[model samples]
Target: MDELSALAARVWGELAQAVSTRGHPWRTATLATVSPEGLPDARTVVLREWDEREQTLVFFTDARSPKVQHLQHLQHQAQAVLVLWHPGLGWQLRMTVRTEVTFEGLAVTSRWARLKMSPAAQDYLSPLAPGESLQGLSPAGASRPHFAVVHARVLALDWLSLNPEGHRRARLCPPERAAWLQP
Candidate 1:
């Protein structure tokens, strides 16, 4: 591989490793999207899956969440940015991606099957929608069916590395190009 390809591959390697490495810095990423009102919204989200070959990342969220609503409002042309920072390595990756949201499908069923038995499932079981006001005691629900899966197809990734010796930056767009940028 050439120098640029090698560097891009290394970045993808870190992302793949973060999928199952709980302590990895990229395990939690900041997802930023534009709401229907043209306002920017950002939130921290867990890294559930990653595929280097497909240039894709996956995460789970509540179907009723504002993020979902934002993506849905954009429909087929939904675009978002995912930012990952590694304090230990002094590296940061900002990925531009096209997003797709699935409320029910194999993606949702399979993920739900694995998640339903875990404590994290409680996040989707709330009686009220996300950001709703809490008044009286919470009511118990049998099964909260608000699980949603988001698939992000990475279009380009801007990687920056900070080091005491020097700093480096690159922009990687798979299949065709990877170029170094001024840092």
Candidate 2:
């Protein structure tokens, strides 16, 4: 393989390894999006799927959440960042991505079906939308169609490895382009 392809492979291999390893904090990433007013908003989300070939990452979220609104408004820009930090490995990955929100479709239906069999289904069953004040606890109900899937097409990936011996950083761009950066 070419140098850039090798770099991308190595970086993606590390990420996949991190996800596969148990108790790895990198399994969750902080997704940062911009609001309609050009304000930045961030929240923690579980890493659901990673497509190496397409350079895309997936995460599930509530459709009614503020982040969804932010994503909708920023869809034209399609610019967002996902940050993953592994303290044990001392590695940080910053991915700049183009965001796409899918609320209704075969993909959403299929994922929702699989989620229904697990406890995660409860997350979509809430009667009240996210960030709403409630007078009392609400009982869980059937899964709502509001469960959404977010696909982030990675535009650039910056990997920072903070080793005790020495720190290393690299930037990877699409179509086999990579460069080492001073950390």
Candidate 3:
């Protein structure tokens, strides 16, 4: 492959290796979304899936989640950001990708129902809906019969690596030429 592809591949290798090792404990990333007023919001969530062929990432959250509300308000901006850091590797993925809520599709429900969860984990969903202020500690100890699971899928990642040895900060952008910029 060409230089761009080579660079991306090298970084992807680092990501895969780092993710598989015990060097870094920062596995989960902060997903950031912006509202219409240019306000910022973020939440810490687990890494659900990754597709190498499509170059995408996925995670799950409630449909009525505050982050989902912000997403709905954005309407036209279909992209959301995921900030990941591997301090040990001195690398980060300023991941930019298309975000879509997966729930209505039949296949989606099947995947949801198959999720491995404990009773305590299921307690997060209280049937009372999200964002609704509850009366007491009752909701905190409640559980839904069958919790709804919605996933946010992201595609197309932009990676940046810091080479402290050479004082180099390089960047890789896709679908075009990749260049190293001082960021």
Best by lDDT: 1
What does the lDDT read for residue 21 in candidate 1?
94
Sort by TM-score, top down from the best: 1, 2, 3
Q: Candidate 3: minimum summed lDDT over ten consecutive residues — where?
A: 145-154
Q: What is the alpha-carbon lDDT for the whole of candidate 3?
A: 0.61
Residues 93-173, candidate 2, lDDT per residue (tens digit)? 899998898999897998888887788877777877789787685675544556999998899888888998999888876
Error of 1 at 29 (Å): 0.3
Which of the two, 2 or 3, has more TM-score?
2
lDDT of 2 at 143: 48
- Give per-residue CA lDDT, model 1, range 85-183, as digits (tens): 999889999999999999998999999999999999988888777888878746785365789999999998899999999999988886476788899
Clashes of each: 0, 0, 0
lDDT of 3 by residue, 48-96 (tens): 5555556655666665577666666756666678888877767777776
Give candidate 3's TM-score. Answer: 0.74
Between candidates 1 and 3, the one scoring higher on lDDT is 1
lDDT of each: 0.90, 0.82, 0.61
Q: Residue 100, candidate 1: how far off, in angstroms?
A: 0.4
For candidate 1, the TM-score is 0.95
Sort the predicted structures by lDDT, highest score first: 1, 2, 3
Report the Cα lDDT for residue 171, model 2. Answer: 85
